[model samples]
Target: MKTHRLVQNFSGYRALICALPERSTEALAPTLKKLGLQSELIGHSPAAPVVLPFENINADRDILFIDGDMTLPMDWRCLRGAGRSALPPAPVVGLVGIEAPSRLKALLLLGATAFLAKPVYGGAVYSALFLGVNEYNRKEILVDAVDVLYEKRRRRAVVIKAVVSLMNIRNIDEDVAYDLLRKESMRARLSIEDYCEYMLGLRQEQDKNENAHGERQALKG
Candidate 1:
C-alpha cells in the first residue's frame, strides 16, 4: 500500500512540514517536488491554521505533521513516518532534545516514529517519507494493542471484585474470598468475566454449548 495512494484516495493536504529555527526546507523542496507530494509548509506560527481545517481539506486524508517544539523519540517519529509514507492516518513527527535512554524509550513507547537532532536535514525528512510504511494497518494494530492493555486492567479489577463478592456472599475474610476465586478460576478454565458470570449464574445459556462438549466426551468414554 503506497502512502500516496492512501492520501490521494482520502483527500486534503497529506503532509504538514514544519521546521525548527535551524532546519532548512530548501534542502528537501526538490525531493518533495520530485515525489509529487501534496504538502504544505508551515514556517512561523500562524503561517498555517492552528485549528484542524477539517471542512476545508479532505475528510479522510491522514495528516503528516513535522513539529519541532515537542520532544519525541526517533523510533516514535519513525513509526509516524512509516505510517504516513505508506497508508492513511498520516504520521506526525516531533523533535526532542533529551538524550537519556529512559526518556527516549518513553517517547518511542509513547509512539514517536522518528526524530532528529536540532539541525534537521532534508535527507532525514525525505527518508521518513520515502522509507514508507502502511498507515491503514495502524488503526487495526493500535486497536488490538489498546484492547490487550484494557483487558489486562479489566482482569485485575475483576479479580478484586470477585474477591469482594465472595467475602460478601460467604461472610468470610478477604483471604477466604481470594481462595474461593482462585479455586473457581481453576475449575472453570475461563477468564474473569466468565468466572464471575458463572458464579452469579449469569451466562448459563451461553455456557450450554460448552457444557454439551463435556457431555459428548463423557458419552464417548
Candidate 2:
C-alpha cells in the first residue's frame, strides 16, 4: 500500500560508462555533465572482455551505460534461465548501436530501463536518465514488498502459536483469543505477528523468573 514519488532531479548521480572508447561514448559524457551528473568512463575495450564494476555500483548514486555492441563476459541467456539476479546493482541505460533482437535482449538481461541510440543525441539524454532512474526505483520497491510478504508468511506459525497460548491461558475460544491479540497489537503500534512475538517473549521471561523463585524457596525449605 506504499507509494513513491518519481525522482525528477538527477543531480549528484554518477554515470558509469561501460563501453569501448568511441565517438558515441565521447559525446555521451558532456551530455551527462550538462545534466549535473559526473561521468566516469570505465576501462572497456573490444579486444578485452567487459568487466562490470559490480561491487562499486550503488543503486542510489550510480547509473550504468552499457554498450549493446560489445559481447558481455557473462552468458545472459544462461543467467536468466538459471534464475540469477536479473536486476543490476544500478539503473542502466543501454548505449544501443545494433538494433538486433539478440543485442537488445542482452541489455534487457542487464536490466536496462532506458536506451540511448548510437551517436548519442544530447536532447535524448535527459529523457533516458529520467526514465531509467525512476524505473529502477519502482522495481526496487516491488522487490522489497515481495521480501516483506515472504517474511510475514514465514512468521505465520509464530502468530498461530501465540494465539493457541492465549486461548489456553485465558480459557477463551480461538476467535476471542485472535481478536484480543489483534486489539493488543494495534494498541502496541506493531503488526500482529510482531506483537504476538513480543507477548511470547514476555511469557518466557515470566516463566524463567517464576522457576528461579521456586528454586530459591525449595533451597530455604
Candidate 3:
C-alpha cells in the first residue's frame, strides 16, 4: 500500500554497471546521463575494488547492469532476495552477449527485471530501465503484502486463545466474547492481534497474583 501508483522517475538514480570491460558500458553512459542517472562502471573481476557490495544494494536508488559474459565475483542470482526475503533488493538489467540457454538461465536466476542485447542501444535504454525498476517495485509490494499476511496468520492462534479465555471467565458464548474483544480493540486503537496479546498478558499476570494469594492463605491456615 505504500507503493506509489505512478512509475518512479529515475532522475539522480545510480546505475551500477557490473562488467569486466569498460567498453561494455560505453554505449550505456550517454543515454543514462540524458535521463539524469549517474553511471558508475565496475570493471573489476572480484567487484570489491570498484564499488559497494551487492548485499548493500538499495532498491530505491540503485539499478544494476549485470553482464552475462563477465566473470562474476559471486553468483549474481544470490543478489536476488529469496527464502526469508521475497523480493530483490534492486532492479537488474542484464547485458547479454551470449545467446546460450545456460547463460540466459543465469540471468533469470539473477532476477533480471529486463534484458538488453550485447550492443547496448541508446534508444532502448529508457524502456529497459523503466521496466526493470517498476518490476522491482511491484515485487517489493508483493513481498510486503506476504509479510503482513504471515504476521496475521501467526497471531491468529493468540486471538483464539484470548477469545476462549474470555468465554470461560465471563461465562459467555464464543461469539459474544469475540465481539467484546473486537469492540474493545477498536476502542483501544489497536489491531485485534495486539488487543488479544494485551488481554492474554494481563490474564497471565492476574493468574500469578491469584496463585500467590492462595499460597499465602494456605500457609496461614
Candidate 4:
C-alpha cells in the first residue's frame, strides 16, 4: 500500500534492482508488485557500478536507487531536499554495512538520507523505501552549490563527447566516472566529486604544459 500510494501520482514508476545471487531477489517480488515497479537482475561484481537503465529514469517515474557497489562522492546530508526542488534529487536509500567513517562521511556530504545495511530484511527494505518516498513527496526539490559543482565538474562536454563516441560507452556522468576511477585506483575512500576535481586539475596542468611547449617551439623557429 505504501509503495502503491507513492507511485500512484507518478506515471510508470519503477524500481530497478542490481542484486547478487547470494542475496535472493525473490524477497523483493512483493514490494515490486505493490509499487508497480519493474525489476531487473544484474550480476554482482564490485567492478561494476550499479547499472540502472537511465532511459527508464526520467521526469515520469524518475525515482531510482543503485543498490550495489554504490559509493558516494561527498557527504549526502548536503543533498537534503533534492528531489522536490527543480533540481534532480530522488531519495537514495544506501546499503552500507560497517563502512569506514570516511566512507560514511562522503555519502553524507553527497546527501544520502538513509543507510540500509547488507543482509537486509523485509522490514528494513520496506522502511527505507517508504520513508524515502514519504520524504520525497513532502519536500521541495532543490540542489545546492555542491550538487551543481558536482554536476558541472562531472559533465564536461569533452568528456561526454568522448564517452558518447565510445562503442562501449557506459554511464556518462562524471560522478560515475570518478567512482570507477577510484575503484581502479585502489583508494580506500575517494569521493567521486573530489576525485574528479583532482583529475580535472591534472588535465589542466597537462594542457598548460602543452601550450608552453608550443610557445617554446615558436620561439625556436
Candidate 5:
C-alpha cells in the first residue's frame, strides 16, 4: 500500500533565503512567488547563523537557502548536518562560491539537501526546491527508524533487571512475573521499559522501609 503523500504543488509554502538581503534574493523572490511559495530573505552575521532562530521555522514546509560565503552557526548544535543520522529541522539549499573544500563542508554541516549556484536564476528555483524538500523527507524516515532501534537496544538490560526484580518480590515464576509486568504496563499507559523502571524504583523504596523496620525491632529486643 502506498502510504506516503507527495508534495506536488507549492501553494502557501514558505521559504527563507539565509544570506545577505541583496540582489540574489530580489531575483529569487519573484520566481518563488510565481511557484505559489512565499519567500523571505534571512541574513546571518559574519559570526554565525545561530542568530537565525530555528524555533520560528516549521519542519515540514520551511526551506533554507544558506550562502556558502560565511561560516555556519555551530552554536546551533541541535541543527542537523549532512552526515548526521538525523535530518535538519528543514531542508536547506546551498548557494556556492568558488567551491572551496572548507566552504562546501560548511554547507554540508548545515544539512543542505540541494545546491543552487550563485547569481540565483528563476529557472533553477523549482528544481532546487523540489530536490531539497523530497531529499530531506527521505532522510527523516531513515533517521527515525534508527533512533527507535537504538532505544530498544539500550533498554534490553533494564528489561532483564526489571523482570528478575519482579520475580523475587512477587515470589512468582519468571513467566508469571513477565506477564504481570506486561499487564501492569498496559494499565499504566506506559511502554514495558518505562513501567519496569518505575517498578524497580518502588521495589528499592520497599526494601529500604523493610530493612529500617527490622532494625527497629532488633534494637527493642
Candidate 6:
C-alpha cells in the first residue's frame, strides 16, 4: 500500500559495467560520471563465461550494465538474496547489441529493468539510469508486500488458536472473541496475529507456573 517516490538523481551511485574489452563502452563511463555515478568496468571475455559480483551488489548503491551480446552461463539463483526472490541484488540495465529474442531473454533472466541500445550514447544514459533504478524500486516494494502477506498467512493459525482460547475462557462467541482481540491489539500497537502470539505465550508461562505449584503442593501433602 505504500507508494515509493521515483528516483530522479543517481548521485553517488556505482555503475558496474560488465562487458567485453572490445565492446564500445567508451561513452558509458564518461556519461555516467556526468550524472554523478562512479563507473567500474568489469572485464569479460567472449570465449569465457562472465562472472558477476553477485555478493558485492547493493540495491541502494549499485546499478548493473550487462552486455547482452555476450553469453553468460551464470547460475541465476545466485541473484536471489535471503528472501529468495528472483530479483537481482541491484538495478540492471541491459546493453543490447543484438536485437534477437534469445539475447533479450538473457537480459530478462538477468532481471534487466531497463535497456540501453548498442554503442552507448550519452543522451540515453540518464534515461536508462532513471528507468532502471525506479523500476527496481517498484519491484522491491512489491517483494516487501509479498513478504508481509506470507508472514500474515503463516500466523493465521496462531490467530485462530487465540480466538478459540478466548472464546472458551470468556464464554463468548467467535465474533466477540475476535473483536476483543482486535481491540486489544490496537491498544497494544501490534498486529492482531502478533498480539495473539504474545498473549498465547503469556498464557503458556502462566500455565507452567500453575502446574509447577500444584506439583509441589501434592509432593508436600
**Using lDDT as the measure, which candidate wins?**
6
Q: Encode model 3's per-residue lDDT on 2-69: one tens digit a residue.
A: 67454657898999888766564578978899999998877665645444466766778999888888
Candidate 1 Cα lDDT to native: 0.51
Candidate 5 stretches greater than 4 Å from native = 1-5, 21-26, 44-50, 70-86, 166-189
Global CA lDDT computed for model 3: 0.82
The predicted structure with the larger TM-score, 3 or 6, is: 6
Q: What is the full ranking by lDDT, best candidate first? A: 6, 2, 3, 5, 4, 1
Please state every model's RMSD to the true fold in angstroms.
13.0, 3.7, 2.4, 18.5, 4.5, 2.3
TM-score for each candidate, following the candidate numbering? 0.40, 0.81, 0.89, 0.42, 0.72, 0.89
Q: Write down the lDDT of every candidate, Cα atoms only.
A: 0.51, 0.83, 0.82, 0.51, 0.78, 0.87
Off by over 4 Å in 3: 22-24, 45-56, 75-78, 82-85
- lDDT tens readout by residue for model 1, 159-178: 67767767876799988787
Over 92-184, each residue of candidate 5 has an lDDT whose tens digit, in order, gives 888875589988887887788889876788898888888888887777777777878889889978778998987887789889988998999
Which candidate leads in TM-score?
6
Compared to the true structure, candidate 3 yields what TM-score? 0.89
lDDT tens digits by residue: candidate 6, 150-194: 999999999999999999899999999999999999999999999
Task: Quote the RMSD, in angstroms, for model 5.
Answer: 4.5
Tens digits of per-residue lDDT, candidate 4, 1-221, equal 01223533322455544455445345653565565566555445655544444444443354444343444232323334334333224555555655778667754544456666666666666666666565555432333444666676765654444333332346456566544665743573645345545556776798799999999999999
Runs in model 4 deviating more than 4 A are 1-12, 24-26, 42-49, 68-89, 142-221
lDDT (tens digit, per residue) of candidate 2 on 1-221: 33666888889999988887888667789988988999887655556755566677788899988888866464444312223434677888998998999889878977889999998889989999999999988877887687689799999998999999999999999999999999999999999999999999999999999999999999999
Candidate 2 collision pairs: none
Can you give the lDDT of residue 90 in candidate 3?
A: 79
